[model samples]
Target: MFLSTFFVVFLLGVGQAQPEDRSKGLPTSFPVPHTDDMLFYLQRSRNENTVIYDLNRKADGTVDAGNPINVYYIRFARDGKPWPLKWIERKFAYGYSHKKLKNQSGFQIELVAYDERKIELIPS
Candidate 1:
């Protein structure tokens, strides 16, 4: 009886899944099956000891091209400055499809920065 109860409890514990984390300030993954005017992705970047700390996608000419987005990339020049780049947005280059963003493709967005240090991505 005790063994059976333990097995049941174990199964229940496994059933209860953990929530996804995305608090590292990393950009979210881009959408696949990219439909019209879909949110590609959002992320942060670094530069050679300097961080660009600014972004402006609409101004970056990355505005939805209707399909096959360029997925423009961006870096930083802020050695010890804030992020978000000079404008409001940056481009994406590559990545995996997110479960939350299933069917969405990964855009290649490079972050130009002088910091040299690499950053990781966290889904939000």
Candidate 2:
């Protein structure tokens, strides 16, 4: 009876164990890139690398109609530099398709990897 009770207690303790926090003890000086055209950036708990979304502009200082958002990676793990997505990443991961909204109010952007959630980009 004592052995069975101990086994049950051990199993309960193991089940109640909490997962380690990966963000804990990480470096505080993670690099952040800033640019004039950058709209925003995203970071994940998986790594220090960041995804940047910027305004795609034409030579005449106007936003590109067909592709208004330029997406790329700021690889902090490598050299903390900006890098374009590879072909596979573009087609399967982070690449997005956008369409102009009616009356030119904004755009409806859909991510290639996750098409269920729609993002609206309205120019100010």
Candidate 3:
């Protein structure tokens, strides 16, 4: 009886340790459809010691066709700047379908800065 109880408890502990959604911030595995308009990918470039907000454009000439949407890069030394972009991307990107954004033609966005424990996006 004790052996059976121990086995059941062990299985329960193992199940709790692993989550159903096993995903990470970098290196996305799921293939999401590309958008012709402006699409952004925020990546941590360890070599440059900065974060790269890569704006990728589709084949159409609507967005910046010549370059890789070349929007911007940010170098931050703030106390807690490591994971804000990743957190935003993880929250927004997961299971995000672009069908709703099809009607939107253009986007006007802004980034603001604040001091201490606050994070902001910088353009290169």
Each model's lDDT comes to: 0.35, 0.86, 0.38
The best candidate in terms of TM-score:
2
Q: What are the root-mean-square deviations of the candidates from the true structure over C-alphas?
A: 16.1, 5.4, 14.3
Backbone collision tally, model 2: 0
lDDT of 2: 0.86
lDDT of 1: 0.35
Candidate 3 deviant stretches above 4 angstroms: 1-47, 64-85, 88-106, 112-124
Regions of candidate 1 where Cα sits further than 4 Å from its true position: 27-124
lDDT of 3 by residue, 1-124 (tens): 9999999999999988956553433333322323333345443322222334344455563444233333332433333232333545433431121111234443333322212222222232
**Which pairs in model 3 have colliding backbones?**
none
Candidate 1 C-alpha lDDT tens digits along 8-100: 999999899787665565434421232233344344332122222212235554533222233333332333323342233332323222122
Candidate No. with top lDDT: 2
lDDT of 2 by residue, 6-124 (tens): 99999999999999887675656656879789977777666778888898989997889899899999989778888998899879988889998998768898889899999888878
- Quote the RMSD, in angstroms, for model 1: 16.1
Q: Kindly indicate the candidate among 1 and 2 with the higher TM-score.
A: 2
